[model samples]
Target: MRLKSRLLPLAVSLPLAGTLAVALPLAAMLHAAAQPPPAGAAPEENAEEPGLAYSVSLPETGDSALDDAISRASALEQLRERAPVDAFGLVSRALAEANNMRDALRSEGYYNGSSRVTVDGAPADTPGLADRLAARGASDQPVPVVITVEKGPQYTLAPVLLRTDPPGFPLGAMGETGLAEGQPARAQPILDAQGRINQALRDAGHPFAELGRRVIADHDTRKLEVTFLVTPGPRALFARPGVTGEERTRSELLARMVQPLEGQVFSQERIEKTRQDLLSLGVFGTVRARAGDRLDEEGRLPMTFTVVERPLHAVGFGAAYETRYGPTVSAYWEHRNLFGGAERLRLEAEVNRLGTTGDTSDTGGKIGASLRTPWFLGRNQTLTFDIAALRERPDAYDRDAFTLGALLERTWSPRLSYGFGPQIEFSRVTQDGVTTDYQLLGLLGQLRWADVDNPLNPSRGTRASLLVNPIYSMGESNVFTRLRAQGSTYFDMLGDKGSILAVRGVVGSIVGASYGGVPPDKRFYSGGGGSVRGYTYQSIGPRTAINEPAGGLSLVEGSIELRQRVSGPWGLAAFVDAGSVTEDPTPDFDNVKVGAGLGLRYLTGIGPIRADIAVPLNKERGDSAFGVYIGIGQAF
Candidate 1:
């Protein structure tokens, strides 16, 4: 397993004093201390500060001695959890890192010989002076620094060797020629050869084949060689992998899912995939595996699995906040083993506390449940029946809705999926405390293509979805046919400085929304948290019956984002988004709200840490909507 890095994001701007560094050389200050003494002190004598101390104060340190000072400070902090100098450990580390960078600059030929290091201090009589000077062994003495560099060492590869008899190793058909069939013994090439050799050995059934001494590089002779002495001391044969404690699932079913085939070698990829394939089933709560017990065949190993399933009858309740949904809490109860069999039944309730519901009211709630036939259409298809009621609260707008729907979903392939359903909706919307009622009936089909190489941290891939609904409604609402299409694709940057550039777009329309006018609950409105950042939610669609859109619909929206890693510990992204909702698809762009901003992401394990500020291109009077979103995972 990989260990996660524990570093925090910077929430505030760094102090201005930290941004400046003198360009000129600062040296030759031997007044007993590097800094000038405190205020109101004697004019003559060794002018020393009262709170500057150090254990190692050399009489004659060089101009760039700050490098040494930084190193010492870092080492002291790491060893004792405290820098020898009186300063926060984090501050010491930051300064030490800066000092090392300056030293490296000199080493890289940006040297200016006449440089000085000055860290001043005042009398211990000042407030909090004692606390600042709390570093052990600190005194009124000069702390030495060293800033110089010399050439780094270089070595060459020696020979290529592998302990295991990789397929066609020494040469031949090259499936595992060990060194790519007579390739040059370069430093990196040798290491690559070793890795390939290890894979080959494992492929041949020696699951425990080991590689020793990665590369042989000689300094004297500009030569290089890669060697991997695999410990393929014994021949290991394949047998059925062990599956223990799975009384719930058929042993045969579990065996079939444990992949890489029976005879394949135990590689990390295969082991991980075995876990993933099982996870996709969503049956077991936790999964774990390993290359089972070792046999006496010197370097042979077996694979084994120890799995524990979560309770079949489970109940859970959780609360989540989304810019689009506002704040919602859901409570659910699911029974995997239903009717003494393998079916599932679930019930849930959801509530919302913000955003307009076409009526611009401010309080809403939803409760719904689904009874699913898990074995529908032979395990791959899902047959679901559900009923729900929703009460929405938009700023100055509000609506309440009741829905009854049924859906059939199927996953035909890894890359293709579809869902078809029919729904009936009844709602009452309130705007500025005024309420109205509406009704809607519709049938819809949805298709999706979501095959990204990495679903969790996808850098490149395409995902597109289409939604269609033909419905009829009345009572202060429009009865119309709806069509919606949206897609997003990403591509990684080319060359060495690789990153990802992604593009996304959405377009929805009211096909025949001509009669009865759009109801307060049926018409789409735009602006707010989720739609165009810097705006509100659902505020992007069509206008309301009042001639002004409480939540605009009927518009085309799109955006392009360019992302890159600006530093080892940081990520940078820039994006521009623009869109608007009018009577038609060809709305004037001049009236569209366009926003742009930059975001910074620190690779936090919780997910990508993000902070973005979007400014509208066409800022209108009293248009003061700017979005701020923070959470785990990517915005998508």
Candidate 2:
């Protein structure tokens, strides 16, 4: 009986003991791999680890991982200095990292080795006693570390293919996009945009689109061929039972928003766009759209919108803090539908506290809104009109101004828009009363070209815009006239790598000098984030005889930037800028105030959050000490 009792317990206990016993060696191995060497001992540096805590030293001391957290692109010099704990699986992971890195750099058109490690001081072989000791106490030796980098293989876009389902697909709409044939198709954004095109086609009532792609490579030629295969199912129809969320949108508007065609091919684009259009009303809490063959035969997809309307149209407020602009707050009231039918109207008040001017006129603001008709002329067009009023006083001009204006806008297509109207202007004297008071009639024209399917971060494509405004005064001593032109361009340097380059230019002047005076507000003022980065608003314009840079008429401004993607929806940029304001129509180019700066971007829902600090190469009296800008979207 005693022997039996002992054996039973021993059997159970022995298994437990074995488990713990075996675990110790395994634990030891892992511990030794990641354990750091103690101070004051020569040791062999081991490979790097992903989770291992590390310290990096760059060519420039400011380079560090913490800096990378807020940066758009990572710095290679800084990346080279990271030191990971020496441990198990370290060498193997390092060896197998090639594929992982290839994927990461492929987006940037640089599909090369993303990392390189070197031991500059760690001896290839430690001294006899040190080696023996390190094997036992790897934690007790402090090892010297050094590394170098070799940037590797680069690839370019090779081709794209188009695939269709059901074997026989209609290619009429494609109309020589050339995408059907293989072309040098580089950049993920472009690829994504192509996806959007497919989606748009589907949305256009072609619901049968099947989006797929294939890649072919030629090793000898170092070329890649990519083909997109599309399978478009049978045409679908709008056989609706009823519409939900009618309370959120007027029944009439909701009805207009619905396009149920019989025998029309279903498209993913149309479904999503209808959803977006619904949300654009700003009346809904949430809007969802789905289209598939779930409700029909022959894979016929029907469009349905599930919507959640806002509970209330009441007051809402928001506030934000930034390094450059201390704090800002804005409040607004909106009605999702003023008189029903998904029409929208909103009113807002705002205040801002800037670092230099405290809370002055620049901080105070007001706005008004109205309805936007999506199909003013046709499905591809839209029309909108708004009226707004504002009052404010700023420190720079020691001025306060109040005015009301009305504007009417029309969009011929999604890519093109234009607007014009009239304004009654009046202002309190502040800057020598050089030009003030007028009933102004303004003419405005605008044009834009943007191919990116996504608005938040356009990976690949180009966007260009131009705006011209000419204002003429009706009642005045002398008939005053002003002409202004602004142009901007967005380019994806390499597209999918999250890299971008942007440029903008502005030129304005008083044309056909009028006997009537021009309002100070109507006159062009430079500086701040939009004009000169390092100067305050109105402090960067044409200089007077005393070399002052506050007042002027004709002005020229421009900026260029190179953006790089870092990690996880972040980016970094380096830029150069130049501009000048001239009293005369023709200003001296060499005499302009030029500056350069770096910027950081966070891709947010609304747009990219931008922060930039600029320093001017040429500085004069009353110039800004340093330029700090915080805002949404690009400065241009």
Candidate 3:
């Protein structure tokens, strides 16, 4: 994290001469002490001496303001480690420490403050102290150290002046330059003022503006005067952007990603946005965007974008475990720049329900491949094609399925996007020992909006999505539509460091079809880690005569969570989820099943590793006592 310094005005009126008299004795004591050895090393002979024990204290002054400043400036408070082998070492260290304390006072505008150090109840200058300590090395007693300080009257600014090359520049527009007359005269404020002025000029189109002079201090009159001489270079406009370091990704594609327009007023913000856009593409390992130091003949600033390409091919594996479903394992291979133009291709395989109390026929698996291309006919759009084969044996049905689909997605802004797609599928499904074959074709549309601060672990903002699918059975005379909508919102109850409240809701329905007419795999079920939890997967809806789940035509689910950071990289969460699946076209709220749970989060650079344990509030005979889930990222 970056540290920022601020200029705070000091309010005090005291005589500097009086405070100096009190500090003069302490300064004399420090001056008489011998120079200490370099830090982290001890003299060979003195190494035998035990480490010295010491304490630092500041006696209260009648003035509360000076006392507070002294406390803040004390060296003892800032030292990470403190140990001295002998009296000589202690006095030497104390002498160096006194100088640091004095500098701290000056930073607070106390140019005439005084400080002193004492060891073993006596001033450091006491004669024969080193010899006495050498004789008492065998003793177990610890040495005591003390520091005294007297901060004199703070200084005030006098007749501050800031001049730039351009005439009639508005210096007042720069807030808190820290150089106004009668304000505290401190080093930090003056330095901060210079930086603020330089930045202001750069933001106003003077990219080359810089400080040209120094500050002058007048101690005799207890006043300071500072001058900010600056060079405000000529304003410039942006020229066409240039790109380099391209191997697979096309140069034209990169050029189009730069948002700044030619001949527009040059801006630092615009340049930064262009850099971010390139990074979002994910094909570049590193990206740099900078404006030329020299202007072109047309008086336009030429900008260049240099990037390093990342490796195009990669393979990885993933796994997830649940108490109810056992474990699922997956692997994938990807080519990020397939055929250039920033296209992507990926192939994946996954197996589920390992180590469960069931035969191989009860297990499930999927194999799939997908391809995506950027700038599909327009800017900020993508076209994707996917094909997959799957086998599953859930309580409601057993099935072998094949699907092919294509989607066109468009991003309107950073926070909003929409997609439409067409899909076809063929399936062989079995229910209650009876088998049936079906073929279906569908068109799907979706809209989504998210303004969350962090995609992995959001502490603020809202996210919402809507999906609609209209389907026609090719083998049978049947038609139906499925619509689902989900929304979630997050709030930081105490800002970044405080707890977060996250709430989510989902609702869906299948229209124009009865339970027997729709595919079992496409029907809604409200159980498992991503649904009502606590209950077994697909176990919360209508049930057959044999107690197996019968999938429903409608769904309703909601969840609420309170997440708190317990310590560094560790967090705790408590949540409640409730939902129901109904055979009716509309949800039946009376049969809702509720689950409550607790979760743990370990924060990582990419996201959080999460584990959750849940128990059903309305447990049925077939429901397990508890369910455990482990995965990466939040459940939502």
Give the top-scoring candidate (lDDT): 3
Q: For residues 1-636, could you state the per-residue lDDT of candidate 2 as single tens digits?
A: 001101111111112111121101111111212232232221224544232222322222232421222121222222223434343222322333333223333333332224333222433233342333234433433332322223333334465545566566666544333343333323344455455756555555655545554443333343445555565544455454234766745676665666543345455554556676667666787887755455455444556677888855777776544333356678887765666655556677776654435535355455555455554444434545555555444433433445555555554455666666555554453444354444556655566655565555554555566555666666653454566666656677664657777777877776555312545555566666767677665666654344433455577888887878899869887887777766565544656777788888888777778888888778787665677677777665
* Pick by TM-score: 2 or 3, better one: 3
| Cα error, candidate 2, residue 482 (Å) | 4.0
Summarize candidate 3's per-residue lDDT along 218-244 as a digit string, tens digits: 556677656666667777788898888
Model 2 sits at a Cα RMSD from the real structure of 14.4
Tens-place lDDT digits, model 1, residues 66-98? 343333322222322222323332124223333
- Report the C-alpha displacement of residue 349, candidate 2, in angstroms: 1.9
The per-model lDDT (C-alpha) reads: 0.53, 0.51, 0.76
Please report, as a residue range, the 10-residue window in candidate 3 with the lowest summed lDDT: 21-30
Which parts of model 2 have CA positions greater than 4 angstroms off? 1-242, 260-273, 291-302, 314-329, 352-389, 395-402, 433-436, 443-445, 448-460, 477-481, 491-498, 514-516, 543-550, 564-571, 585-590, 600-609
